[model samples]
Target: MTRSTRGGAPVAPKRVTPRAQWTRGSPGGTAGTPHPTASRRRWRRTVIARRAADHVCETFGADGIQGVCGHPEIEVALAEFARYTGDRKYLEQARLFIERRGHRTLADIEFGRQYFQDETPLRETDVMSGHAVRALYLAAGGVDVAVETGDDELLSALRTQMANTIGRRTYLTGGMGAHHEGESFGLDYELPPDRAYSETCAGVGSVMVNFRLLLATGESRYADAIERTLYNVVAGSPGEEGTSFFYTNTLHQRVPGSTPSPDEQSPRAASSLRAPWFDVSCCPTNVARTFASLGAYVATSSADGLQLHQFVSGEVKAELAAGHVSVAIETRYPDEGTVRVTVAETVADEWELAIRVPGWARSGGLLVVGDSEPETVAPGMARVRRRFAVGDVVELRLDPAPRFTYPDPRVDAVQGSVAVEAGPLVLCVESVDLPDGAGVNELRVDPAVAPRVADGRTVVTGRMARFEPTDWPYDPEAEDVDETAAFEFALTPYHRRANRGPATMRVWMPCA
Candidate 1:
């Protein structure tokens, strides 16, 4: 029967199709596991890189030049974004905001100027200036279009400014910048043995600037300085866990109760364990970024070949004009001293692998496998030349010995004290291992004798080591005759201390 509907025709109820719901096991749902496709992973990485760049730019750019503390980080983030996204827009924005402030040679940009308004430029150049230089150098490459078009006078000025800074600010210890409170910059050449403000960030920033300089000018000294900083200063900043940090690092150690706070204490004479984080909290992030971008720092290329500066276990892929050449270094370096470099791809051209053998690695020098006999790579530099092939392995071994470092007696902190070091890590004595009531202050070790690992820790024992003090003034020449009492003390790695409790800790103790 034909029934008349709305307009004289019979109409039926329309069936509705449910929206495609994304369920756990439904089609295109991924089923609790992510899609194992390259596109998906690449997209995820792109998003993260973009977000990181945007956060840095937005957070720091809100105040213009006032955001110099985060300037270098932001620049790096932007460069990374531009690299990943293949977008010149991000690079342009970074160049406009970060590099547009002043004409080349930004040496006039004074310390703490980011927070101040009235353009009272500071002539007193410091580590902060080095950081700014690094940021500018990072941006200089990505947005070459802007740099080339923008003020040529400014770029020339900046080059001159950086050259002047490099000449004036360097210390005999190879450390740069100085600050007593923030452990930033000290007066030029005020490199005191008792009070040296070799802030970790300053050291790192120096290396960063020098690295860029190396890229700009194919000089080896910049790479040399970087290697030195990595071994002595930067390596010492991170704790054994590779987490904790020290704002200031010194070669000296002082008595436990003499210093106010750890950061304020001078590291020149003697030093103690590194703290987890500081009030400034810049060192931690600095370390994180450095470690994250470590691959970029390892191998640098020139017209000739590649320069391998630092050695660590990792894989490095360099896209050369010939083809893609991959080098994988595998070893427990600094600790075990062996680094194996394996070539993963074949190349027609002969390439040079310049490895840096740390100055401390004397006597038992570097050893390269696949080549007959252990080659004696110099303490400063090791140049290995060979025609590369797939699966070619180069093995290098440096000296791994526990050395005892003694501070200058003139330094008040460790007048008659010495510290033990394995690789770059300073060893210390925790109060937990010391006898009850007899604190670390009463501890003494004979410099002539070596401390060995006993009961899973370094220990020293000797006669004439008593808890009680002698009568009258403490004479430096007069030797104690009381030789009956002797006690043993155990020591742990400096970075491992403070994890137990608030106990007395000392990196250097009086020599018996």
Candidate 2:
């Protein structure tokens, strides 16, 4: 039987086939033993799942595919696949999954409906709760379906949830899922540093949702969130060479040991160093795909004109509503905030060139066009619409000054501490950056000292004071000798931790 896709898109009928096979790893001995590792098992399960999905696609045709609607990630993927392939079957399946959330289709045995996001329908849910990755994935799917089907209510609901999440649950480093207990989001303003369950997968999902929202609404705010997450959380999750990964990204590590524990999956358990692979291994895979597909997030074409969301050294060609536009973006962005967009080809006579001015650049950076007066851009996006010719140059000078950031007063952790941020990167002090005896907790940052760029990283000069624990728990009479010392410490990007071997690290530093 043949099935037609939604939106009147043409598709050839696919037939079901059996192609499952057993495979072995690299040979070791004469006959290698079966690898019983969790990584191997996980890979095997993924292969099986893909085959099963193919079988489902062929057996049910397009529109005939239907289930009880569990596993929000799979549902989201189905929606995205439908959109990409112009298949209505998967889109309908995605909608069914999203719409039936509150009906309790899945068995919520121990954790209940909240864990599976079944207690409340997305449209009615006020705040995004439960599993952080799952919630973000579900919302992203909603955005995909809503944009395709012209459903404004669903889009609005998701926007509300996003706004609430950004205002309350999100960390300064753009990490998500505040509570370590369920690996889920906690109440409003419940961000905790040591107890954070900000999984790397969640950071990837945050960018996914923000990108979709930006596509659906053409909002600059979503792009801002995308930039922050990409730099601080997503970039920081992986090691420098991309071999090791941190499953749970923490804001602060108070202890000295730098070893990966067997129970590293627990958010409370701090793995000071990144591991080659984790028992779960979701973050590594997610990071791989995210980095590979980063070009799609850099720019997009709207009815008004072309838009550049991210700054990267690449060429973007798009057929916009105005006409065909081609431009080359050259910059060492995130390292420095100067992007030069040279118009390689512009077919249209006039079209708006919208560029995002990051939220952190509050000083209203300078935007200069060819032979035009330098203009200041507000926090959102700066646009210039005029007759354009070939070789037109647009220069955007963004403020890359390092600034101190403080968390909300309601957040109990890091109350008196401050985090340093330069461009999109969140700076952290590693033990390797400090003196031999000066611990991370003992080093204090003098806010008055200006951070300087050195050795491709930011360095903060500050005063350090070593506090010795006395035998008496409470002693009003304590001799205060000279324990203060001056030190210049280098701050590494949060994402690049564990790259220089395992060491203690702290994002928030106490003021001296």
Candidate 3:
């Protein structure tokens, strides 16, 4: 029997003649420990999953096929299987796939070899290139292989690539990919608001790579990157209601787009607004998986104590050399800066507790330890070691004020414009908030006026100007347009925009 993929590609089941024995540890699947038989159900589906690991390891031999698929995914899947089933051979196979890339073994297409990340070897590549999601995924798999094989050089190269990618290629929302064409990464500092092709999958891929690096390096910077991307891109993909999702996240909406039909899958261009469904359907499932396994990214441990990265309201328990430690986290986050951590249970003393203070807290943050006065802490992990007991509380306060943020001068798209941000959330001006017949293009905001949160909404002081249409947009005789009514309007979170209905929105506000 055959199944049709979202892309209309027909996939037929492959029958393996039982040539290779399924073993655990060093070689194959968990033979001694069957995974509860649920994962073993449905022979055909099981074959489909097993075939991906077995056939690829066998088929991609040096004498047979030396190339990888256009999209680099199987490498990471094989590595995951190795981790789950205790098979080193699967890890080796994944390493082989990474090693074989960059040789241009696959024939080139119009988009060029870089589109599939074949222009440079995994080790040689610095700064992500080609399709944003594919480049990130390939790097993620490369990190996986490097971690398992203890390859420091490979890890170092990937770290450099990630830093450069995040610095130059990423958006204010931590969204990646600049060009609408090829769904690929643009040149350094080429980020454009209206043309952003920030696919939700690419955001997920960024988190995946950063998470691996975070685990390998134990650096809080990687955790910072993960938090930014997760709060913006991943959380932004889904609409207010979980029923709809966006295929590509656009930083600006020039035109008001009608809601996508629930029955049909939408094209990338049709996604000015969130769609109920799409043919490719990558965003929904990708988002679903991310949300399901989100706890994995919440907290991690070092040799001595516990480290809390994300600031969501939850309870956490960790076992260290000292003893078992449990704490409950309570925070509204992004909306409010205050985070309260109460010690639920602790068996020992001097267990180091580290909480991440976001880089965006420019002025500095405050950390309160068990009724002590709030002490200023810089960006990075705010750590403290002390004896703890029941009913003890620790608090972290971040600056969640609405402020104007300027972009790099090299970013020509919004060079003179300023965007509004309230803590970790990027705020935007929606057309729905403007007066009748007013457009976002004619909106001019004054940077001199400080923005403030009023009634839980970010209010910015701005004036509406009139742009008279002309046969030629650019003319030497053009005069300064009239600045109409001066008033204050509320700005919505970038992730929460477009839920009211079809609306035009822009994140970077034009300076008057």
The candidate scoring highest on lDDT is: 3
TM-score of candidate 1 against the unseen true structure: 0.59
Instruction: Encode model 2's per-residue lDDT on 274-318: one tens digit a residue.
Output: 766565777878988999888878887765467788899988877
Clashing pairs in 2: 236-495
Q: Judged by lDDT against the true structure, how good is candidate 2? A: 0.74
RMSD (Å) of each candidate, 1 decimal: 17.5, 10.5, 9.2
lDDT of 1 by residue, 192-303 (tens): 4335556677667767666655555444455556765666566667766665566765433343433225446334313345554455667778777777766666766544
Question: lDDT value for candidate 1?
Answer: 0.53
lDDT of 3 at 149: 94
Q: Candidate 2 at 338: error in angstroms?
A: 1.0
lDDT scores in order: 0.53, 0.74, 0.81
- Report the error of model 1 at residue 56, Å: 13
* Model 2 misplacement above 4 A: 1-70, 259-270, 454-456, 470-483
Model 2 misses residue 76 by how many Å?
2.0
Error at 267, model 3, angstroms: 1.4
